[model samples]
Target: MTAVIEVQNLTKRYKDKHALDNVSLSIEGNAIYGLLGRNGAGKTTLMSILTAQNFESAGTVKVFGEHPYENSHVLSRICFVRESQKYPDDATPRHAFKAASLFFKNWDQEFAEQLINDFQLPMKQTIKKLSRGQLSAVGVIIGLASRAEITFFDEPYLGLDAVARQIFYDRLLDDYAEFPRTIILSSHLIDEVSNLIEHVIVIDNGEILMNEDTDAVRDRAVTVVGDKAKVDAWVADREVLHREALGRVVSVTVLGALSDDERAEVTASGLDLAPVSLQQLIVRLTQKAGAETSSDNQEVR
Candidate 1:
């Protein structure tokens, strides 16, 4: 299948920093992709470039088989919901939805109305007067309702509480199931959206660290928590991602999965086997290249 998005030798630089290095990636269409990274890790820069909201210092970008810049057809097929989406001072959610409907080719008026009611967004209230969560609801509504071929959501649910966040997730998944489109989400809420994302793209310190299936990334590490000595003995020969300790009980996040014999040995040694946290592993991977996980764990190179 043709890639929905492609970046070749991409680099974005500021006066004194490289927000994105020589990154190259291809995104297959019609799948939910998690663009994982911390703030200042180039997630926004990459998205903005893809959506033509920002100019790239160098390299090439193609969306839907063509460069997106100044291309109305490509631009109209993409929707980017930013954390700080701008609006007219006196405009309401109704106005915003109206504008979106005019712009997006596949705008679903009925779907937009359904989302507005589900989110309880005030149609008459000015967007400037809405609460943070309400504002986020407005963005989420447009994102879901627009039904663009390639949608990029850059932390669009900032101030929403757990319940509201779940609503967004559920509605997004439901809509995606019926009408599949490429959805790229950049969020710090890793585990929460883990289940929603089938593909994972990790960026760290201005470079692509990992881009693979979520299941494959999860299989890259395992966490073992138990007696310190046993944990250390088991992990000493493996690369350690992170470690934490509470008195004598130590939890070590190792870089690879245990073999059958290793798992048996862990159980035999009274060491508890546990799932590794994707967040912790990503956090460690994003740290300075040579930096290890602190004194709690030994970094076995």
Candidate 2:
């Protein structure tokens, strides 16, 4: 399978700040990729560059095997649904859908209509008058119905409630199953979308931290749950990513996959091994880096 998106030595600078630092990555066709990072970690910047909505200071970007900048052939095959998607003040959901239908090569009118009804989006109401959830719904509708070869959704569920958010996820997964396409989602709600994403790309500060299969990333750490004393003993000398305690019960997430000897030791220790959540793993990794940076700054001071 050919790569749908590729970035080589991509760099974006604002004044003296580097939003992206020599970031190089390739997204294969028909995969759901989760762009994970803390705020100001360059998630939006990278997405904007990939979609040709913003220019990069240095590096190369190829979408659909060609440069995306002003290239109608490549541009038309990609859809970027973001929280700040703009719309004409007077336009309604109906108008936005119409415009998207015209622009996207694989626009599905029937699918769009179905989504509108499912989301209960009022077509007659002007987009400016719609609630925040409604605005997000419009974006989700277009993203799914457009069926673009490579779709980017940057925090597209801003004000949606739990029910509405679930609807969006369900619909996205369903559509993706039938019409497979590369979907890159940047979101802060990690736990919610953990299962939906097969691949995870993590960014920190201004650089790529980790890019691996979701399962592999999860396997990078394991959680041990048992008596607090036993858990601590097992975790000592191991790189602990995170730890939680509830009275006598304790859980510790340790980095590095368990070796055969280690596994036997864990089993012998009367401790149960629990699967670590993707969100927890990412949170710990980024938070650890943040803490280290803070400590270094303090030392400098």
Candidate 3:
């Protein structure tokens, strides 16, 4: 499949700091992408640049095969749903949807209305008067109902409760199945969005750390459970990402997929392999960022 979004050597500098350092990533069509990173890691910066909402210090970005900045042809095919979306002080959810209906070619008024009812959003209330969760709901509805070919949702569930978040995820998947467009979701709630994402893009300190199919990433690490001594012995000399112990039992997640022989050996040793959690995998990848930087410093010296 052709890439719908292509970013090459994208760099965004803020005075002395580099917000995005030579970042390059391509996202394919009809895939749900999870853009994940710790705070200040440039996930938002990259999204802004891709959507033409922010300028890049140096690099190229192509959305739908055209530059997005000031280019209506490319811009019209995309929707950016931000947590803190700006609205005219007196604008209400009804007004927001009305504007979206005019902008997005594939806008579905019926879908928007359904979302409003499901989210219990007050359409008549001024946007400024709406609570944080309500404000988020407005953005979520616009994003889902717009049916843009490529939609970027930047943490659109900030103040929503667990139930509301679930509703958003379910509705997003339902709508996506019917529409079949590329959806790039930037979220911190990894476990919640894990099942929805087809691919995972991890950023650390303004650079791409890991970009792979979610299933492939899961296979990169295997969690072993058994007696503490047996699990520890199995993990020895392997790159252990996470370790947890419960009484005499221990669970250790180590990098690398085991071969048939290795798997048989592990079971023979009385240790069982468990599925690695997406959250755990991401945590280990991002947490090692500091160690990676430190090693770079040493090499530079």
Best by TM-score: 3
lDDT of each candidate versus the true structure: 0.89, 0.91, 0.91
Q: Write the per-residue lDDT of candidate 2 for residues 54-119, one digit (tens) a residue.
A: 999999998888888899998889999998888988999989989999999899999998888888
Model 3, 118-204: lDDT tens per residue?
999987899999999999999999999999999999998878998999999999999989889999999878898999999999998
- Record all residue pairs in model 1 with backbone atoms less than 3 Å apart, i.e. clashing: none
Q: In candidate 2, residue 5 scores what lDDT? A: 87
Model 3 worst lDDT run, 10 consecutive residues = 283-292
Q: Considering summed lDDT, which 10 consecutive residues are worst modelled in model 2? A: 274-283
RMSD of each: 3.4, 2.1, 1.9
TM-score of each: 0.93, 0.92, 0.94
